[model samples]
Target chain A: MRTSIIGIYEDEKVLMDAFNRLQSEGITIADVLSPIPLHGVWEKLKLTTRLPLATFLYGAFGAIATFGFLYWTSVVSYPLKFGGKPLNTLSFIIIMFVLTINIGTLFTFITYFIREKMYPGKKVELAVPRTTDDQFTIVIERPHNMSAEEQKKINTLLKETGAVDIIESNN
Target chain B: MYNTRVRGILIKGNKSFSDVSRDIIKPMDDKTPLWWYISAFIASALLIWGVWGFYNTITVGIGTWGLNNNVAWGWAIINFVWWIGIGHAGTAFSIFLLIVRQKWRTSINRAAEAMTIFAVMAAGLFPLIHMGRIWDGFFIFPYWNTRGPLWDNFNSPLFWDVVAISTYFMASFVFWYIGMIPDFATIRERTASAVKKKIYGVLSFGWIGNAKGWLRFETAAILLGGMAAPLVVSVHSIVSMDFAVSVVPGWHTTIFPPYFVVGAIFSGFGMVLTLMIVMRKLYRFKDYVTDGHLDAIARILTFMSLIMGTAYLTELFMAWYSGSEYELFTFMKNRVTGEYKFAYWTMLICNGMIPQLFWFKAIRKNITIVFIISIFINIGMWFERYVIVVTSLSRDFLPSSWATYEPTITEIAVYSGTMGLFILGVLMFFRFVPTIAISEVKGVLKETSTLKSFTDEN
Candidate 1:
């Protein structure tokens, strides 16, 4: 069985400094929970993000598809002449622009949901009740091979890094 | 390196993160305030009365309105334009400010976005009922049907309006709901009641704030903001085309698109200011929706009023320069000197002149004066729509066709009802949710920490 140590931080500055010190000391961080996102923490944690590119692709696809729909419907599908205006005018371009943006934004949201593993009735393990309100929490899972001395050293390091409180639980 | 006076400090000084959370969340968790109840009651009464009016209007047919053959479009279109114009500032606050990286928008965007949704709801009702055949409203959308299935006229600006307004509503609604999920999670965590917790949990979609989650959320928000920014311009432009495409003298002009867009933003700000001033005071959110926000909005209003004044001048200049008798009469005689002259001058004074007072720093800062000016601007915007729709149509080319248009009791009741409905929506938002974004305010507190200290270490 492996045990995990949780540290609750009051200030974001303390949390970031602790994460850096732990990383330098070759301690692995399993997870961090925060009420609001910490700036630059993702880059520091070396997290890879494909959301930007994916959203961009979605936007491009949306724009092309919307433009195609408008063109196909207005110009080819059902063509009509009114007020002697051309079948294809610049006005429908406005409709296409709105639809492109709408679909693109909507798809980006769906991608976010999938990436976050968020959905209705999904079970979430809350580290602490206050984690979503005011507290910043970091979880450090003890490795199976870690010795007693190494575990003691990590405990001292967490305290030294200004953790407001610490809890250890077996998983 | 930071100013001691808190130049751009969104949350007030001397408040910690917990304090920010408590201040914002307290309103939601605590008992509903007496004022909120009173306001909601009034709105409900008005809404009920307006429903009665709407029912009467439907059953009695179009005869309930004073729309004669000449002045076919009256209070319904005017109210529609007014409410839709008010909704513009919400998207402008959330999307435009986000793209521009205006950090201060964090405080007001949530409520402003709510205002957008409610105002759109109010505006949308007018057009459906204006049809006099509200049941056939679905015919407006392009859909396949069994009968010869008459397709929508894509060229007609009215059809364009249906598409544009509906798109604006959906986009704004989605944007508003998604942004609230994180906050909903916070509320879900903090609340003691099991039912409330469960409801909020579902609404939040099990949001567990992690670095990866935030990264994706930020990317999505920025993309959505980019998409919504153009909508603020395009929606109003399409709505203006509804009038511009017509051959009516006052309504038809190339400048209507830009003119209406600017006017929509201006009126939208006016309504936002009116709501925010009261909200900041009632909700005790003075710390978040600070004086700096008011000053910034006032300055924007003043600048918008200046452009609106210029646009008005351009219209007059074009009317004179066109050398067309109808355009000249619509601008010079019927609008300025004829029966609807009161409305015309009121629009000029309210929309064009009153907002200039905001140019003065003292007036902009004075809450009382700002409130008064906002009311004036709101009145002026309604009158502007009225002057355009009524005066232009009332007196056409032939004098025999000229007839004065007067709104009946039913029209007035319906308009007032929409007002109540808008207020009711705002009240419900205040009671159910944190009027300010709690997480964003904490973020601002971090960003503004430099203002509290003179240290260069940060």
Candidate 2:
């Protein structure tokens, strides 16, 4: 969305090093993209993620609500007995447990998709086409307060850390 | 720490991430193979025939099948249990293996998961046909009827089955789709056609391979896997309850739940072996689906066969020890030396004795033998369900009403039709989706230090 220096690296190791170096030097990196997910990159960038926490909460809520709903339906709404079984049975517990898991799993996945803004028909602009294949890319949005010397230093650092190509894009 | 080689090298030939992507994505991009189309054509023909059989059954009434008042649960129930059993291996491979930290599952999990979805579809068909009045099949659901305001009996195992099975299908579908997202994104990047790209893009949901996204993806997979692992056990257990809850002597075993679960995994691995052996050969995925994967599956199948064999013997021992006349009659008289003794003995040999061949290293490693054994196991599992359902029901407490059961042409056609539908689903899946999870395969490739060393040497 803003003018950014996009650095493309052929290898994940070099891209990670350059990304950490830039983060350490106090440069605000817009994002790093790679063919495969690079784990620990968020911790390396010192960014806190709430996705896992959100998933857990969503699952818990779903399980509780599903169990409650099953209880209300079987006990409160319609108290019909079959084969002289009690109002509540151990078999209902198994059904309730499975429903909780089913509902919880579906809810967690849906919430993850929604929170991540991942949905059908969303257009994604690839900064580097090869980022989805065999390359890793780092995008650094230029700060208005940065001096020319600092910009030059960042460019040299990216090149030294094995960036095969550097492109300044307005995309 | 170096025990990654315990299962042998998952991927061979020093394949890099790019290599993995290319190999997986090639089938998607390339023209459909002649064999694929030929197989699809034959499957389609059989599916059409099965549909006609189903139509005839519905029109001609329940009398169309070999089912009677006594043998009410016939081929339909048998096929239902058989399909459900076949579906279990996929979930077991994906979820149980993931929980246990078996990384090699990544290579074959996608296709196996797809098989689960299709097998469940096949399983769902039998109950519908068995209903006879399938138009009123919605009665199985919990929704309030607009006409008579009928309410479903939640206490019924059949009702629980309706809930469990649909839940199982939806859960497996979501889990499969979620796992496919990143790989679909890769396909989006690799494709040349705009239409294909757009389709894959939407399916991928704008995956950017960001750190946060990856973390969420991994977390979600684990969560879904954890939920699915239990479901894989429970769905089959509930299916087993359809029999166990009944007072039928042979069907009312306390061991049905765990026994069914183990048999499901055993037969499931058998189906997986049957499919994967052919798939690896056809797709040339020897490097990814390597001998280690086959060996591991064989070992599990062997273990399951032994468990199943023990369960079979336990039924006999229970029958004799309980001294219940009916139970003893079902096992000793009806099953062992009864009219259907041939079917009983075949089940014993196919499901029990045949898988024991895998105990030998050479047989486990032999693709041809594994394939043949897997086919026999599938047949054996089918007969096992038949023996349980028909044998127990055909000769119940009353000796006056005893009659031998045989499946009619319509029933056989419908069963054959489901086979066609299943093969068609697998064929379509192979042509379209990435049969192997490319990203996960790449992840495993990165984790394998042995591969890293090999690449380093090169």
Candidate 3:
């Protein structure tokens, strides 16, 4: 029920030293948050979620909405003849294509939200102000198998690495 | 080193945070002056009268305008294009500059963007007002009205205008609102009043100082910028299609789409310059809106003018070289020399001629010269549309249908009203939100090149 929380200092050398120490201690990190993306954190963390895939899917959803809405409005809604053109000119594919493209773009925005788990009304849980202005942060969720003493040791290890400060979680 | 010029140009006026807050907030124009409320009321009254005038036109028939068989597209079309053209500067400031990394945009981007929203509101109103039945304007397109009064012609470019303009509005609004959040938070922090603090605080959306919010906000900002850039381009291109897709001699040129797009930017930037000049003077944000911005925008205006010049020449060549009598006559008789010939020459002399001065650093940097030239640019853009719509329609393929175009009194007043509306939107917005993005300005200060290198060592 106890987890070994670890915080690594944002300084490049200090962060690298802490990374080596963590690997040496066999402590696996859950996630890292930096003000900006660090140079090698992606490679070190092995994070493999395809946010782009989610984005692509959301894009398709938006396109479908656009196409479906336009089609519905055209065929089912106020249908009248202009230029004596048929309801489904099929030649009008270009307009639909552009509309779908615009809509898909509109939808791709949603993926950014889902990826961050943030929305307009969602509660913001920004722990450190400097992360936006100055600092980089690395967070590792403690493993369930870790003992209370092991968790304490991990905190001590983070403190030793010049983490600046540590945030401990019950999880 | 030259690349950092825009950044340096942006941050050079190092008056502190409080100075910015005060400069941006202080009412420079005597607010208690009767004219502030009087002008607002007069503009509002004009707006009401314009709306009533439009209502009368619509209630009577589309026939109320001077638009007839010969001049089928008149003031509404002209107004639509004008509003759409005005709409361009906002996204250009909000997206294009952000992409090009012109940090100087942070100062006037908010105001220019607010202009865009109101301009769109004015622009989008025309089609519906022109539709005759304000209640059933939806019938113009096969959109959402299940009664099936008329099916939308997919081939018509106007349909695309609705889609493009609406999409642009929504995208720009998102871009505007997302950009506003951090600034809103800054305002919330700066304001002492509990009501404003609560209002802005709630709008900032529970932004607890977290790395997660920072990460998401950054992604959203960049992504929105990217989204806005394309939307801006596409919107104008779509607007251009309203003419390019047509077969009416001068209006039907393949050159029109991109040509109009460039013209939109030219005019839009001119308006932006006019605005910044006024704002910098009035709000005492002289530090934020500097001479460098005027010079840089003048350069862009010059570049756009050159593109539009080529487009004009190519259009003429294509008309002549294609060996079509109608096309040749359209260009030779009307566009170059006809009843509207004066306006055509005026456009060339203003949009095409005045911009050439921008090649000189002195004129480009000279605020007074730039301001005057931008006014000319705006006039030229309006004349450009006037030439395109009126002259093109006034004389079509059939000689029997030919007639001179003129705006009804209603048309003139409504346009004046819309301009008033546009000015009012900006004037009112400053009363609500701080003109410049203070947090963004502060953030830029922190990222000043001199300090950035040390952070790397840390």
Candidate 4:
């Protein structure tokens, strides 16, 4: 039988408990969840990338789309003329350029949604629901072949580490 | 010890969480007074009707309002200058906050930025509306043509206006939205209804308060604010161009650009004080807005009043030194003995006389008094517009063609109705958007106490 790991934590205290239990019990952890980020979770998970690249790419992409779309619309198609003037007025292009910047930069907001994987109508399981305002989550996996005694020790450690509720799910 | 010192300064205004909740949500009920709904609906209705009126104004010709070859622009142009002048506060507020390094800017920026957008909307409408032939408005732009197309004269001020206003509006929108993301997350998490939660969640874009996100947010904000400061100044100077580029006696001056910009700020600060004063009382945000904000605004008023005073003096000096009879007569008779001389002197006293009182510590510090003083400044600034437009148009190069400028009844209705629209937009905005930035103020308050900092909320 495979078991999933779940911890109910209100504060950083239980987050610490989950970490210690995960380490001490050697429970091939399925996953750990909390409402907030625990202090050393990145060290625990071993994440090694920066988000600056993601932000930069999304923002620059927005600016370009803005300029390209307007230039095509005003300069290329249906250029307006008045007072014996040409259809494509360079002065009017300022508004077009500005519209692009506003629209383009605004579109980068979609990137954040994609990066978070939190979209409308799709709900993620509450690793710890309080993560919205407070508390952090740390998820670890428990392997399939853990002995019952080993499982009991992990449970005991979880209780001692301040996990409000420790659940082993049947995966 | 530090906590005690901070607490000591915290003037305990008696308000609870529910009072805040109730005070903010006071008008939310369907049992809302008949007058409130009636007023908003009627104003909104007139606004809708006014759109048609404006449509006629454009379609029928520039002849819809009082315009002749001598005075090609009237109410539309006047209101355009007024509304654009009004748009100054949003970028100005952001700049002032950035320069002073005010952390509380987060609490107030959203509401103020909305002012920028709405005012810009009203301002932009005037120019388009004044163009009369709506379809042909694009001719104002300088573009390449099929037949040696005549471009817009870059030297013309209107071109400059087009550049400045668009830049300011775009920068303001980006700056305003970026600031809202974090707060949107808070609303998303706290909102009870699934629909609201979902809406806020979508708007928030999964902004988890990671350290990395905060750094980039800061960088983007600083960059936007930096762009906006000079942009805001440029925008007004461009609006000034529509007047300064002209050959009219009072209008033909190099000093008009900087003078108009200063007057815009002077007027903008007054409007900010006027709104905030009421807003603080209505929403019980007295503590958040603080006397400090009002005081800062007052100091700005004093400085700008002096600048405007100098601009007035400089104009008079230049007109005399140039030795032009018409220009000299316009300045001397304009304020001293012209038919519109009352308006001119009223502007002088209101913009100059009232703000001089702010140089003192006592008057500027008092909210009730400062609010009154700001109203005077607003009147002065509006009259300042009137003086510029009416005085010049009423008297020009040829004495035989000179006629007094009078706004038609339709112009009066539309102008009054535009004010109605402005108020309606502001009232609706205050309702839909959280008027005060909830998270930002909470952030300030959090420093006061040890937050439980964690919860199993779900």
TM-score of 3: 0.80
Candidate 2 structure quality by residue, lDDT tens digits, B288-393 = 8877788888888899999999999999999999989999999999999979898999999999999999999889768899999999999999999989999999
DockQ values for all predictions? Answer: 0.54, 0.55, 0.21, 0.15
Question: Of the candidates numbered 2 and 4, which has the greater TM-score value?
Answer: 2
lDDT tens readout by residue for model 2, A63-137: 677667666666777777778887666666666767777777778888888878899867787778677778888
Clashing pairs in 2: none
lDDT per residue as tens, model 4, A1-171: 544665556555557656766765555443343322232544454433333454456446655764464445445654444455554455444444444344434444444445445454443334344444444444444667867786677667766777677665453
Overall lDDT per candidate, in order of appearance: 0.84, 0.85, 0.69, 0.64
lDDT of 3 at B355: 91
In model 4, what lDDT does residue B92 have?
80
CAPRI class of candidate 2: medium
Off by over 4 Å in 4: A1-171, B1-39, B45-49, B140-155, B360-362, B446-458
Alpha-carbon runs more than 4 Å astray in model 3: A1-53, A64-93, A105-171, B1-7, B15-42, B140-151, B447-458
Over the stretch B1-458, how does candidate 4's per-residue lDDT look in tens digits? Answer: 00111221111244333233334344332244555577688878778767766766766766667776566667778777787777788778766666556654544566777787788877777777676677887787656676445444543557667766766777777777767766566556655668877776777666655433444455455555654676666677767777886788989899987998888877877887888887777666765676656776788789999999998889889989999988887878865577888989998999988899998888877778998998998889888888888777777888898777677766765676677787788778666566665434433443323322111110
RMSD of each: 3.3, 2.9, 5.9, 7.3
lDDT of 2 at A102: 73
TM per candidate: 0.95, 0.95, 0.80, 0.74
Best first by lDDT, ranked: 2, 1, 3, 4
What are the runs in model 1 whose C-alpha is more than 4 Å off? A1-3, A169-171, B1-7, B147-149, B449-458
Recovery fraction of native interface contacts for candidate 2: 0.55
| Per-residue lDDT of model 3, residues B101-198, tens digit only | 77667777888888888888888878777777788765655544444344566667777777777777777777777666665555555556778767
lDDT of 1 by residue, A1-171 (tens): 667888889888899999899888988888788888775577777777787788778878877886676666677877777788887877777777777777777787788888888897565657577888888877888778889998888888899999999888663
Ten contiguous residues with the weakest lDDT in model 4 chain A: A30-39
User: Model 2 reaches what TM-score against the true structure?
Assistant: 0.95
